[model samples]
Target: MNESYKIISSSILFWFSQKKWFVYSILISIFLLNLNTPLGLTVPAYHSLIILLLVFMLVTFEPIPFPAIALLTLVLQVVLGVAPPNVVASSFMNDAVLFVMGSLMFAIAIVHQGLDIRLAKLIIKIFGKSKRMFLAGLMTISAVLSSFLGEHTVIAIMLPIGLSVIKNIDTQQADGKNAVLLTLFSIAYGTIIGSIGTPSGGARNVIMINYLQEFSNVSIDYWKWMKHAYPILMIQLVVAYFVLQFTFPSSLNNIKMRGFKKNVVKIDVKKNINHLFSCLIIIGIVSSWFAFNDIYGLGIIALAGALTFMIFGMISWEEINKNTNWGVILLFAATISLGFQINETGASSWLVLKFNELLATFPSNSMDVSWSIMAVLSGLTANFFTSSATVSLIGPLAIELHPTDISFALSSAIASGFSFLTVISSPTAMIIYSTGLVSTKIFFKVGILMFCISIIILYLMSQFYWVML
Candidate 1:
């Protein structure tokens, strides 16, 4: 008895001294919070989702590494029985994960052999010869590429080129903000614009399509997606240019990146006809996304491109190993599984129940008044819960309560664009923010302004394109 007592006292002291007690206590609390769901305590599904979300948010901002977040996500999922080993393992194979990895592989190849920079220089030489011209040219090029390819991929490939251009330009000291703001806004707005290009341009766009096709009558295909999204994308590009002009007005007269372009072009890069062939591969893959809707999906095709890039010796297998962020891949999978949980555990319905009640009172004086009110509020909520997941939770409710209110559903859906509230808002935002160039607060400030302006634009757009005419 005495020896056991002494052992217990030593363990208690060690636990307290090492701060393990607090850690264990929190784990125990979470365990207990989730444990009662099976016993009829009626623990909210969103309660679990909220806990996971809080943990994800904290990990996102913490000094801890992203790999650590990946690890904790799985361990916590298992402990809470949110996902088991088999379920968590399956998350690793999510279509979004495959898409992300495949896209990154393509990005790696472009970044590696200097093709991306070569393309950028060729673009600048063709359209640019002056400062304002160069800026406009850059924005135009970024918008064009982002719309077709992917936004994060566009940023990864072009940011270095942009930075190098800035380095060469002898800007006046006072214009530093203009330079930084222009470059950053070019990336942010360009990316947002890019996402509107295709369903696959942004992950959320794909998710939105799935929601519509699955839950509603509109089964949008790739061409149909572009028909709706392209108009919005083009308008966004025009508005973004004006916004940038208002935000940063500079007159350097001459913008010479001649040396930069020459350096980019003349360099002896890893020459391969394979680079040219990769375009064919991409085209075939994309064509499959449209043409073979009866067959396998695009993720397989994209992943095949990545593999084919290696198998054909266009890129080395070692290169793929170096570029892939497996941690992020895992986190995406975990979040996807979490999305399922949030839906399955009655969390999504519960959330919609409450949010629908809130959406019920939009200070309606007229149809336009009610529409605009719902638009702004839905857009704002998108900033917090994310455009995809928020729409996932609230989409059905919006459709059901106001089935005829296309303006309401469409604004609420397209308002998915307002995910710039924080670094944690979207995969693209997270991808860029993980880079050290920007901060969470800076994104929030710029994003909030962008969102406010965009809310008005979306309201206007609903009148023209998506609203009940």
Candidate 2:
């Protein structure tokens, strides 16, 4: 009896240890729900805020599967009278969610096309001349490709090339280790910096665009978004090169350029017409996004691209189904659904009013101050949480903060791309972390500097450059 009792107690303790955050989230949510609704806020709005708190804790801790968190979000909205069943269901799936699904499918298809081999050869010919040149090249190429192909996809392609370059290097010495770390960080940071350049760059961008259109009735087409964000991307590429150069100083002076080329496989696109054909399909999809996105929606255009890839037999359905992250899609849809309700129930507006009260305490209540705060908050939140979730949950509050000034919405969206602070902040960061070369301590150390620089650059661009356009 004593032995059995000890075993039962140990099992209970083990379960509690693993599930403590889950219990805390529910307990705190229940405690908040019991409080009286604040002044100037409806009961439904108050309840929605409680749900948001619950979501933040659950996502940050991830005590349960993301799909579970997502399902709970949907169920809670209906259960707490935050919105009706139909309303909740309507918000659960929208163009933004479709875009996320299609983008994931498209990424898997693009990876299957073997363009990375061709890209490797091209990168070697162009940028493999020297160590500094190679680092700059990786960042520039990654930024340019990621701006259109999405950071996750571009990283998937670029990481292999970066790894190949550093694979043969001896890491026992300081400089060799620096070379390996620099190459990887360049690819990761470049992918992140470029993810804000266009609407297709990241799901967070699309999420913000959806919020802007839905709440403010403002429409920003693909080219228009590029025009606004591309300049900042360009500046970041240059600044990031210098920042990374300073942070990870390496001299591959002894290493020959031939060594870099020998590491990557030689594959010419001309030898394979299918590779060229795949490129044409991608171009057609991008062209459609630029010309017809307003009519068809970005989500539909993205799906069309994935379908086109399928029709041509570039990638199999089985491949896409296996590679696509369904749980992430469900989580995005659920968060978006909650964001919609937050806006619909007046929670975002009420939060904005409270923000305004705080702003009033400041001496200068300029749009600049408000914009800066929003951008910083977005960046900080995004570092801890997923970028898409950050925008999905915060986009409404940003739009409600300054409905007339689109800069608030734009800056917040762009700032969320500063996913440099943590390993799990973005897929690109996680990709590099998986390599086992860059440690978590280095991530935090280098990330602090880059994050600061990015915020400063964003502020300058928003103040001067964004206004001219």
Candidate 3:
């Protein structure tokens, strides 16, 4: 009887330890809900604001799974009378959510076709002789692929190749650690910087696009987005190259490694047919996105591409289903829904008024100051939370501040892609961290430098290049 009592007590303790934060969140939310606002906002708006804070905390700490946090947000919205059940359900799914889902599916299809080996060989062939050139090649390749394919997909493909290169490095050499750091970060920072180049580059871009279209009636098509964002990508790539060189300078002038075997494309039978078909599908999807995205939308085109892959037997539903993180989709959908609630309930406007009063202390209300503040806030917040979540929180406020100038909103979204401070900042960072060779201290040290450089570059672009565009 005594032993049974101990087991029950331990189980209760374990549950309490695990769920303590959740309980605290609930209590705090209740307290916030009961308080009368000095800001003179509506009760529902205040509730939505409190819910947003709860979500940000839960998502950052991840005391619970992200999807659970999303679902809890939805439940609380209805439970607290912030929104009715029907309104909450309607906001949960939208074009942005669909785009995220389709993009993940398309990314999985591309990754499953064993294309990374071919890409790796091509990279080595182009820049294998010189160490600096090879690092440049990796960054360029990762950036370009990520611009079109998606950051997570490109990083997932490039990470193994990077690890292999690191493993093959002669650790007995003096510059071994530098070589490893350079190689891994080239892939990581490249994947990160590339994510802002186009809408397909990252889900956050799509979310921002969706927000602009929904809230501001501003539609930025694929090529137009590229026209605006690609220059930033190119300039940042150059900056990233220099930053990596400065941070992790390899003593060796050249690296001659022999493991990169050439993959010759043979036009022989079923294999050739599959490769050709896959290439055509990818090209077609990308072309359609660039040409007709405003007409048919990116989500449908991406889904069509994934469907074509499955229909052609290049990939399978079982494989795609297994690899896809449905939780992320749910989290994105929920956050988006919550963002709309914030906007609909006037919470975003309320927050913006408060922010404007703070900004009034500054000497200027010029566009430059506005742009810089939004960019810095979005960029810094993204280093701690997911970039998409940052966009969801800040995008509405940005739109509220600059209702006519879409550039401010676009800049904030693009700048949020600069996630260089921590492994948790972005999926690409997390993938690189999984290799177990990178030091957290080293990651932060170099990341802080890159982060500062990127912000300065982005601010300059906004002042100069973006102005011309």
Rank ordering of all candidates by lDDT, starting from the highest: 2, 3, 1
Q: Judged by TM-score relative to the true structure, which candidate is superior, 1 or 3?
A: 3
lDDT (10s digit) by residue, model 1, range 1-469: 9999999999988866665434554565566575445432235453555455554453434434556655665676666666567866764465555665666676566456556656666767776666666666667777667665666667776666666666554444546646655765676677766666676675555555544544455555667666666777777777777877776665543334453565564443345454567667767766776775325544555577677777777779787887776765555555555555555465655555555566567655455655665567656666665555455445554554454444455566667666667666665577557655567876786777777777777766667765333
Worst 10 residues of 3 by lDDT: 254-263
lDDT of 2 at 459: 92
Candidate that would win on TM-score: 2
Clashing pairs in 1: none
Could you tell me how far off, in angstroms, the CA of residue 158 lies in candidate 1 after the best superposition? 1.7
Superior candidate under lDDT, 1 versus 3: 3
For candidate 3, write residues 97-196 as lDDT tens digits: 8888888999899888766666777788898877678879999999998998888889888876777666667755658778888888999989999999
How much is 19 displaced in model 1, in angstroms? 11
Question: What TM-score would you give candidate 3 relative to the actual structure?
Answer: 0.95
- Locate the minimum summed-lDDT window of 10 residues in model 2: 252-261
Name the TM-score of candidate 2. Answer: 0.96
Identify the runs in model 1 with alpha carbons over 4 angstroms from their true place: 1-41, 44-47, 50-52, 63-93, 170-172, 211-218, 265-274, 361-414, 419-446, 467-469
